[model samples]
Target chain A: MLQTPPARPGMREDEVDTPALLIDLDAFEANLDTMTAHLAGTGAKLRAHAKTHKSAVVAHQQIARGAVGQCVQKVAEAEALAWGGVADILVSNQVVGADKLARLAALARITNIAVCADDAGQVAAIEAAARDAGIRLSVLVEIDVGMGRCGVAPGADAVALAHVIAASPHLRFGGLQAYHGRAQHLRRLEERHFAIGAAADSARRTVEMLRQQGLDCPIVGGAGTGTFELEAGSGVYTEIQAGSYCFMDADYARNLGASGKPVAMFRHALFVLSTVISAVRPGIAVLDAGHKAVAIDSGMPLVWQRPDIRYVGASDEHGKLEVPSEAEAPKVGEKLRLVPGHCDPTVDRFDWYVGVRNGRVECLWPIAARGGFY
Target chain B: MLQTPPARPGMREDEVDTPALLIDLDAFEANLDTMTAHLAGTGAKLRAHAKTHKSAVVAHQQIARGAVGQCVQKVAEAEALAWGGVADILVSNQVVGADKLARLAALARITNIAVCADDAGQVAAIEAAARDAGIRLSVLVEIDVGMGRCGVAPGADAVALAHVIAASPHLRFGGLQAYHGRAQHLRRLEERHFAIGAAADSARRTVEMLRQQGLDCPIVGGAGTGTFELEAGSGVYTEIQAGSYCFMDADYARNLGASGKPVAMFRHALFVLSTVISAVRPGIAVLDAGHKAVAIDSGMPLVWQRPDIRYVGASDEHGKLEVPSEAEAPKVGEKLRLVPGHCDPTVDRFDWYVGVRNGRVECLWPIAARGGFY
Candidate 1:
């Protein structure tokens, strides 16, 4: 059902198979510690988004490093994490269908499970599933802070949905899910600041409305790798759902920090290790990793440590790198590390992550929740 | 390790879980029959690309309906197809690493297996693996033929690689793999014809060169859904590797035929069925299907049977649909069918394909090689 691990323990980096997802364990551990230390006593707990890494092994590491719990987008992901022993899980996105809600409720027996709803009908569906399963499921009323994707309106409409969940015997009102997803990639610091500022304002109003209805908003969750600091400092968001901080991608590295440098809080830990399968041409080389291996939704992957070579184009299974004439062409079978443009979907492409340290394979972790999209 | 199937047999279409991949059985059957009838006596055999639909069940169906065999891009895919009882498999792309080549060579014991190579180093690596595995492996010299991805130069370079394969004791020179990948998506009929025309000329010369070297070219494989007819018509190509015809995507649907209409050869047989999880805002709706559910490399998905709605944007787990003011907004919990922009990566996202016919799920097929990216 899954491909074999690209590298085994004790193997050198060059010996690992091409198109394998490689994690720099040193940088990965540094990111975990850095993020944990940065978030300590910040008033906002880190409910690290499992949707990025999609690995229960990584989730356990994050949990050990002071991450309060894990946040996922699908019930199947929750099931995977729970089965992998992740006790506190939240389906941060909306869980719609009865089949999925039932699955979510079923996990509540062994783990503390929570899901989001943006409408009365979704609340009804979750309620029915929880009631049928004889479980009390935590429900988060997701308010559209600014993303314009999911969630209900912020003020009265969100309060109304919260009341519906409060009225359901099988459901508990968790709080507001005010995620500004688009702001996470806004490149400019000012753009992100403005976006999260508006998002925080909307979430604050929604919380007030809910409090006016005699409901206590225990959790106001929203944040990603790029904007977690803004939300953490906003005093409104209690839970920061920053996932990519543990595995920084090329897109996140492009974001300008307050100090005018690429966000340096986390180091780039994730890489798609590929081999130059074809370099017969003069100034062009092809890699085994392409769209199928590393996602290009953000843009083409950056050739790590090779400034002269640029990933120009990609087909399904091949990525074309434009090599400068002055730079030596990578010979056939030569391996290179590629920083994926996006981490989540790139991580979704593989079953195993070969964790490397000092150019040697140190660990092979199964992406337990990989492709858990139901 | 895979997620549970979204739907079981005998379930209605609406009852199926959201973000599930659906196969319209009727259209799928039509595509198979139409492709078979079109390729009958064309002198080129249909070697359906398994990379498009990584299901051994689908591979068997294609083989049963006159396909010569299946073509894959990865060794794991070949292994999966062979283990699923596919007797013949060609890795249309290069198998780079020694580990991958060893796995491919191991498969030669049970199934007729072949792989592509461009460089002398790759040939040497494959020869080493085949020799170590004690198997005579078939090797194809992939010529650029204008794809500019993999493959050697057309005439002399291809002949030189073919000779290298012929000289190897464990390797046999199969033929030329000259796939014009970019030409497959040419919007105009003239553009595709021109591209494939040049590709055929190059392939024809390469074959002549191989023959001049006293090597018999057993196969000259190329062609995809968009240009299969041209390659089948060309006297030089012995095999048509058209895979997307089995499940036409939105990108392929946008290609114009000779008659100035959408290429009507293949019907849209695959769709991502998603539930409208959020519709609280006016003129906006959100679906459970997004980048994780459907690939957006080609473009955003098309709303099947809903002309008034447009899939405008997508995040990781949510798709935003822009609805016309006059059109009825899709209510929460309403299911909609989405024709994926690119079918290959979209299919790779799911573990199961729910086969539907006449508004009911008739079969559940496991995508046996869903994540076969080695």
Candidate 2:
């Protein structure tokens, strides 16, 4: 049910099919190394989020680069990573249903599996599923740090949920999940610093409450690409859940660093390779990649190396580019690379990633957990 | 790899997994019949757009109910539909790359394949590929009927391209491809009427120009769910390429009809079924479905049948809903249905469609062309 790879190893970049996902091997490796080196002595380890890449191959690479484990959003993602030989997997979000909890519990036999919960009913569901599957499950109480999306209230409510998990015979209390999702794209470094500061405070108070109840919070996991440095420096967060740092998206690049410039910690490694399919007009060209190929939830994609050409509009499968009067319009069949506005959903659009280096294909990796959204 | 189905054939709606794509069979059948009956004797035939559903099973159902063929945006879609026994397929957009054109030409062995082009260079590329494949490929001259996308200027430019295709030995001049994509969501009925009126004028003039050049325009194909009535009444568009009418989206629901009310032609049949995973607070609840499960390109998905709850925010795997103070908050594990903002990309997120009727799973259909975006 999957499409074939757009290009094979050693093939030139121009030979790859249009609208295929391309990973710049040099930049990708540099990004991996940069993040690993930055977090070397920070006292916090990387639990690289697989929800961004969804490729077990990428997860394995991160693990080999000193990531403690892979963080996933769904039970199916945990299954995919486990099947691909990932030893430790955490479902960073809540797993609510019986079918999903049963699947998560089943993974415990092959690897270390952990999940998050913000409610007592969710704890009961996970405990029941673990008991029925005859396995022990690690459960984390997700506290509402600052996102106000998911998770229990910061101090007392989170402690209450942790006590429920600790009392269950088949469930083990596994610290806190305090991800501030909205803060990750605050655009200014000061805003992110303040957001993470409050998040860390909430998480710290919750941990103290848990400890007062005779419970130990082993893993205080929270952080993303935009504010990983703040959480890593706080001495509160133990596991960084940074995902998009592996392949910087256009939206993340728009964020300001502490130096008052665009965040430059990670290079743009992921791109949607497209072709100019129509250029009949003088100042207009159309690309084959649109909403289905690259996501627009954040914004329109940026033309990788062509500042003269702007992606002005998009339909279902066509992206319209406005060419500058000073620059010549791109001809038909001309190839271009687009830095996606958002990485996660754009990565979900493809089955394989054409890894390229120096204009040649270096590797082709299958997106094993591409659409594992259940 | 694809994830497991959210529900089996015998499961109830509540028993289905969270974040599953669902098709209400009753509403879906009504939508299908409404479109079929609306275009029964309107002179223009229905060429259902497969880009919306991406399921050959749904395509066969559309064909069985009197659709002329299936319209796709990618060659991979044509391959999947052809493999699933769809005989007639039209790639309703421009296909430029040599690899994609070759694949589209190869599918002519089992299906009647046609594609669109707006440039002389694209015509030469398609001619070369079809010549190499030893097949007579049908080529349509796409005219830019005010969409400002991938098409040539109306009269002389379209005639020139049609001549280029007709002059090629391996290519047959199909007709004119005139689609006003932007006009589909104009919100006001008069705006759409004016847009379609201008599009039909451009198409009519292009057809006349082609006739002057001794070419007969057999298939002047254009029109979507939003403005199919105007194009069908225009006497120029011979085929109606309405895709989203079978599974109306929330964006389309916002469009106004001639009577100054929400367009009531089609019922909302497609939905993303989600479970409340977090509800610890007074009015805020979080759902399991987020950007990965539903596309937010057009807008946020609406909570079906819950006017008091508004989907205010979304992260990768969580949707934050704001409930009214007068209404009770949704409890954990409570199932809810969401009408996706955009039907095409949202349908592209899932692997299977859980067809439900009377609160029970009626059938499970694999989305045969879900990720066929190559």
Q: Each model's TM-score, in the order given?
A: 0.97, 0.98
Tens-place lDDT per residue, model 2, A251-365, is 9999998889998999999999999888877898989898889988899999998988899887778898999899878888899999999999999889999999999999999
TM-score of 2: 0.98
- Candidate 2's C-alpha lDDT? 0.91
Q: Is the docking of candidate 2 incorrect, acceptable, medium or high quality?
A: medium
Instruction: For residue B248, give model 1's deviation from the true position in Å.
Output: 0.7
Q: Which candidate has the highest DockQ of all?
A: 2
Q: If you superpose only chain B onto the true chain B, what TM-score does each candidate give?
A: 0.99, 0.99
DockQ score for candidate 1: 0.74
- For residue A140, give model 2's deviation from the true position in Å: 1.2
Residue A185 of model 1 has an lDDT of 90
Error of 1 at A353 (Å): 1.6
Which regions of candidate 1 are displaced past 4 Å? none
Q: Total backbone clashes of model 1?
A: 0
**Candidate 2 at residue B326, lDDT?**
96
Instruction: For model 2, state the Cα shift of residue B252 in Å.
Output: 1.2
Per-prediction fnat:
0.71, 0.81
CAPRI tier of model 1: medium
